[model samples]
Target: MQIIIVGCGKVGSTLAEQLSREDNDVTVLDINGQRVEQLVNELDIMGYIGSGISFDTLMEAGVKKADLLIAVTGSDELNLMCCLIAKKAGDCLTIARVRNPEYSRETEFLKKELGLAMVINPELTAAGEAARVLRLPTAISVEVFAKGKVEVLKFRIKPDSPLCRMEIQEIGPKLKSDILVCVVERGGEIIIPNGTFVLQERDNVYVAGAQKKRRNFLSVSASAPDR
Candidate 1:
């Protein structure tokens, strides 16, 4: 995809590098000439030094022919303006990085009004991730799906865990819960365990199911005495 990223800061540069690695034609724009030069030197991508909201700068960055325009400028308003201009000037998808908490609440409204493809609030996303991890303290990571109705949790089995020697088939019945063990990482190997597959100590497990059921399972697991 031919993409134009407006902002050469950490987030912008990281996006450019990743997209470039995936063979996307990426062009980054920023007011800082040195940052642009640094990214251009480090990555196989183009860098332009200019304000993201400037029509001429965006045109010069080939926004007309681009497949996507990502506005990640420091200012939320500037990011929105960049996306608005991109929509009016080109038939491309626009994504804006909006960090302001106030603006984050109206993301859907802003997308509808400005025709943005996505509005990403990194701070809000990070907070949500942290909250999910905190809710399940034993989980290394937690991901929600199905409109937050389903959860996928990653956790490791301790050496003294009752689940250490349990077979996959026994988990649901023993815990009196319904959940799917999706993946198991043991001894640096990944396995999609079947019913007969046995869990071991230090095995990192990924489980997915309805959010309530998963929480129930976790609650029981946390209170289970080592046997």
Candidate 2:
């Protein structure tokens, strides 16, 4: 895929690097000449030094032939304008990084009016993640899937915990909850554990299940007496 990224800051440069590594043709555009040069030197991807909202600059960056355009400039309005222009000029799929909370609420409206494929707000996403972690304090990370009906949680096994040295097969019978252990990370290695797999202390465990079952499992696990 051919992708054009606007801005040379952390997010834009990181996306460029990752997309380039994935064998995608990536072109980075920014008004800062030095930043564009640095990224070009480091990543060997195409770089354009100009305002992203300008038609001439975008045309020079081959926006007409690009498959996707991502605008992640510091200014939300500028990013939106870039996407708007990209949509008009190339009719390509466009993504914008809009950080302002006020604009976040109007995401659907903006997408409808401006023809944006996606609007990403990093701060809002981080806040949601923090809230999820706060709700489940024992979890290192919590990811919701299937529109909140399912969840994948990561947590470490504490020493002397009931889960320590327990076989995966015993969890359903002992805890009386249905949860699937998806991955276990221990000693710098990752394992897809089977029912017979025994969990050791300090192992990072990832489990996935329906929301109600996961909640029940966590509640039971948290209330279990250390053995």
Cα lDDT tens digits, model 1, 1-227, are 99999998889988998999999999999999999999999995798999988999989999899999999988999999999999998999999999999998898999999999999988888999989977777777887887577778988887766687899999988989899999999889999999999998878889998777888887776533222
Report lDDT (Cα) of residue 13, candidate 1: 84
User: How many clashes does each candidate structure show, in the order listed?
Assistant: 0, 0
Error of 1 at 148 (Å): 2.2
Poorest lDDT segment (10 consecutive residues) of candidate 1: 218-227
Can you write out model 2's per-residue Cα lDDT over 160-211, one digit (the tens) per residue?
Answer: 5678889999999998988999999999999999999999888888999876
| Each prediction's whole-model lDDT (CA) | 0.88, 0.90
Instruction: Record all residue pairs in model 1 with backbone atoms less than 3 Å apart, i.e. clashing.
Output: none
Residue 206's C-alpha lDDT in candidate 1? Answer: 91
True-structure lDDT of candidate 2: 0.90
C-alpha positional error of residue 59 in candidate 2 after TM-score superposition, expressed in Å: 0.5
